[model samples]
Target: MDDSELQAIRKARMAELQKQQGGASGGAQAGGSAGNASNDQQQSVEDLLIRLVRSGQIQKKVSEQELISLLEQLSQQESKANKTKIVDNSTICELTFPTSVLKVKMNRKRLLVILEEQIYIYSLKNMELLHVLPVRSNPRGVCGVCQSPLHPFLAYPGNNPGEVIIFNTDSLEPVTVISAHKSDLAIVSFNPPAGKGSKDDRLLLATASEKGTLIRVFDAVTAQRLYEFRRGSMPTTIFSINFEPTTNKYLIVSSATETVHMFKLGEPAKARLRPSNSETEAPAASANKYFTSVLKMLEPQRDYTCLRIPTNGNTGDTSSGNGKTKNLGSANHINREFKSAAAFCKDMVVVVTSEGYLYQFKFRSPEFKDGELVQQYSLKSM
Candidate 1:
């Protein structure tokens, strides 16, 4: 070969070596972030390093067995920053992103991170990046995932307003796209998995819009409409919407108003449906009879149970025996960004407010008329 050609080959070889070193260094930094990685994270790191070597992104001078031994040493090494070597079991691993995190949701097998325009799904076991899903410009981080391990599904806003994509995380495919509302979506939620014997159990999804008067539920797999619920006649911001985690029979809607509404689902509500009594059956029977009439209905279904959070008490001036602060302030003095969320835990209704108060109410009777506040906890103290 001519002297000029030899020089060119040497330069090319030097560039290739530099590229490989850069790739290896990046992988090492990712591994170092998981200082106290769980066994799963360590295994994932080993798998990644092996793949890099096999793909020529990492040099093959070192055998795979030697690389694995080095990984073991790194995993066992204590962080120099913590001389005491104290381990925090609370956090399993850490994930970094370029953009700010708008929302995060997790299930048994998956962890979802929602950013401004993309959603990232990671495996819960090993914290491996499973998918990067492109979504509409969702500044509010509107997204939901089914908690059921057997049938995992994710829902997010699609390209168009009011459109939602139902994605099957296990199959790594889009199941269906639903035109939930005409306006932009304010909330997207999925009912808890049925955990039934049959794997084909229907996955139900709920959605609300910027005009948060109406809430709709759909069969995610089939794109079939299941239920339509009315929050109120007036338009207000919907704060949070969640299904009863256990039974999936009751749906709770919280909004800007002080009142929280709970509605009974009709069809496809069979997951762990609590045994019906006279009081419960009365409402369902009346709803069925009313809808069966020959006359068409103008409004959607009304709330089955309504719980109004008191906004008129003393504004943090007084303290109860348990030293918990009283009502934050009058309705007019409430924070403009105040948000409220409600969930069902066994028979009690748990309500949490952004003002740092949590109230647990239990129904006085089967009628479920504004249950008495059985317990109160100051979230700020915690």
Candidate 2:
């Protein structure tokens, strides 16, 4: 059946299940009886979803938000207490901790909880506490989890500055550790796995340091340096780093500036395995850098295309404005003057700003070099 037909079936089945459960909840007694009925209702919804998946009426890799919406619908008539715990039904698990949570990221199989100083990994099947990893001062809870079920990896900051620890969530062990930069890390992201699911495909990770001048893509399995894209010379806080969802060919980076950069990942540099404590520069390299600084300036890698959102509304200047582009660098705890984020959503480039504006641009295919502003709208009430 087509997706729309399958969705109709899912809605009909869920509505039928909701009606039956709604009638059952009416006569439920208070205290333990009400709790038992609530649990039964949650399980009934779960069973209905399972049958739909088995019957090929629902795709296993559907959006998590849609599943959560369905779960909330099932529990909408339950007690307020039960409604609070609806996430348990959607995720098939729940976790409680003594400390406040810094961040939470999950996929189909595992749930990762980041606290102030420690990280917890748990199985979604039974809420089994799998691993507890001690980390440094991660107040931002910087962590990247691979969404692909086949390439089950999780990346979090290591104990030292700019160190990234890649761990295999499936095997419950460490994969590799990469010292990505000389300064502290600001953002860590993994490229979405290729849609074709090849056995030879290795996970690719992208990291931006607090320096913010450059973004490095690495081989997650081998701890090798692959490609580095120079954002700019000036330092600014990077807001987001996102790889295109399906092909993983293009990377979108947003920062303190109004412009959003999209880099097409062409061929990468020769993979060089990083050595431990390799911070010192060689004499020949130092001499070359000094001469390049004194005589000719070094050329940095340029972005394939960029979109600069108009500060005013649709009447503002639409051109991406020419000049030397800046890197998405660190603001060093300074208040961001401006903020924006960009990502590839289907065939269009989507940009959203903190000033309450959403912009969409369409790019010509094949080369994908230029962008045409197709839509713009204000998110705030004027």
Highest TM-score, which number?
2
> Which lDDT tens digits does candidate 2 get at residues 61-122?
43334333224221212121221121432433334555655555676687666666667766
Checking candidate 2 for backbone clashes, the offending pairs are: 212-329, 231-327, 232-327, 236-329
Candidate 2 ranges beyond 4 A from true positions = 1-94, 197-200, 271-300, 315-337, 365-369
Give the RMSD in angstroms, all C-alphas superposed, for model 1: 19.1
**TM-score for each candidate, following the candidate numbering:** 0.63, 0.65
Model 1, 1-382: lDDT tens digits are 4546644643454354333322111110111112232233345555665675587643354345434533432232222121111114454345666565565566666666677776776665555666677666887777887877766888888766898877777666665667788999988888876535534356789899999999898887766567788888788877777776555777877776666778887544223233334565687676666555412332367777666565633222222211122454446524465566676655666666655555555633374433455555553443
Question: Candidate 1's error at 251, in angstroms?
Answer: 0.9
Cα deviation of 181, candidate 2, in Å: 0.7
